[model samples]
Target: MRRRVLNGEICKRAACREHDMHWKTLERILTFTEPPGYRLSQPRGSKVDPFLPIIKEILESDKKVHRKQRHTAQRIFERLRDEHGYNCGLTIVADAVQRLRQQNKEVFLPLSHPAGEAQVDFGFADVLLNGELTKVALFVMTLPLSDAICIQGFPRECTESFQEGHVRAFEFFGGVPTRISYDNSKVAVGKIVGNREREVTKEFLRLKSHYLYEDHFCLVRRPNEKGHVERLLDFARRSFLVPIPRVESLEELNEELLRCCTKDLRRRLRGKSVPKQELLNEEQQRFLSIPEEQFEAKRLQTVHANSLSLIRFDRNSYSVPIFQSLQDTASASMRSR
Candidate 1:
């Protein structure tokens, strides 16, 4: 074909069209008198090739060290140059290190959360409160099976916020989840008894008892057990709290969050044929009924009003009735009232 194209008997286009060969290949073929024998290309050597064992050893040892103390690509490159007399660009070392680390990276198994099960968590974001930029804690409750979420903002994350968050979430969801997963937050967990057992806080116990929902606390330092809500917290902050919502109070901010959560029900998530609301409706059928009794969420403490008609609670002072001043009025100490 090359000879035919070159001999002028046939045009290069015609020869290439008939032979189904590329123009560049025909041109190369025409440069040789006959077909060249096949030759194998030799592999090229790399400056870091000799130090691969050392690099692997360093990476292996890194597994036992603190993650922040692990050697970065730049540090590895510097060590190779200084200690092993390596002469290579940082790009090569970085590429090699990244590839090796990818090979050794941890993998996670796919998880499935059942209907009527939920995960709870808290995150913080900046919101405009009364025209001032204020940081607030966001309480998030997510139904992992349906990907439904309920978010509310609070002045702070405390027992009050935690319990109130659950109450609001249950009301918003129209039912209580059969089981709820949580981290070992101090508001919920009084002590870590063992690998799995927990000494739950009194407030948490009261809330759970009122709601009649099973509570599962994740293992200490292992947030991945309830990773669904963990991821949703970031999503909620970025999606719902972005642009720094301007509100008059935490109540107003919570109202806005409720609207956002309600609007999100219309979204059709990936791999789902129906909107989130439909999935939530189906999940609600499996959920426990919301109790008819209203739950009082507060902390109780015994205190005596001082001579100045003041009582201290949670590091702050409040005025009591003057008649109760200088008296050990335990009733006045009930913040729940």
Candidate 2:
């Protein structure tokens, strides 16, 4: 209105009254660069509205789960259908869940670790053990900064395997890392008390004390804190463990894998000029020397195989991957028990 009046298109009094604005207000509006926008259409509603409280409950519950372990939209839809009697389609539920996850997410700055700081993680791979299909646990250690990695295979992720993985990684790297980051697995952490405090197991503490290294635990459900190794886990299984090499035992498989890992260091990775072999040499030098005495990091407990072929350890039962192994191994333990 003020622009029109100034251009002599209409009288000032008529323009002011036409737009229902005082003279000063019209002047202020003319000085603005851009006008604000208002959204049109009726109030938006959701088909999932009736069950939003349920969705909120699920989202909150998911916060306690590791990101990789969280329920997906398809899973949530299945649950809603089977358990909650939800009639909505999958798309709407997915969108709502996606939005909720986005809202719940917390972002952090990119991480940088010192030369001797490292991360430890476990991944699974399928392989052939003496012409028999077997699934094995892969233990991975990585210097987060230089991308230097050490890998070893274990029959299971038991306390003993966990301990031996550390010892083997330190030996492979030729020294101990100053600080290692880990997820709060029961193998390392016994209990979680409040105030950023964790009750670490005695064996893990012994390993830490012997090596004179620090162990940092990520917040519950947030493995992104140790994400470098987590990313490498996928690459290890796909690139290193693919086609499932046939070997007599886990020991033989690990020996071959170590050779493969050593060979990998000779090649250059993407976006880097120097080969990993050179960087790995330099990184290992930064590590502390190996302890004089070998640290005992294993704990022994009597366990029994249940009718379902699951082994019960310290009141927790773990499923056996091979049925024959259950019969063969369980007989030995049962006779001893």
In candidate 1 the C-alpha lDDT for residue 146 amounts to: 88
Best by TM-score: 1
lDDT of 1 by residue, 87-119 (tens): 879998998898899999878787789889999
My TM-score estimates for the predictions, one after another, are 0.68, 0.63
- Return the lDDT, model 1, position 189: 92
lDDT tens per residue, model 2, 121-206: 99888888988888888999987766877888988887888989999889887889988999989999999996458999888887
Candidate 1, 248: how far from true, in Å? 1.5
Q: Residue 297 lDDT in model 2?
A: 62
The reply for model 1, stretches above 4 Å from the true place, is: 1-65, 71-105, 304-311, 319-337
**Candidate number achieving the greatest lDDT relative to the actual structure:** 1
Model 1 scores what on Cα lDDT? 0.89
Evaluated at residue 162, the lDDT of candidate 1 is 94
Alpha-carbon RMSD of each model:
11.0, 11.1
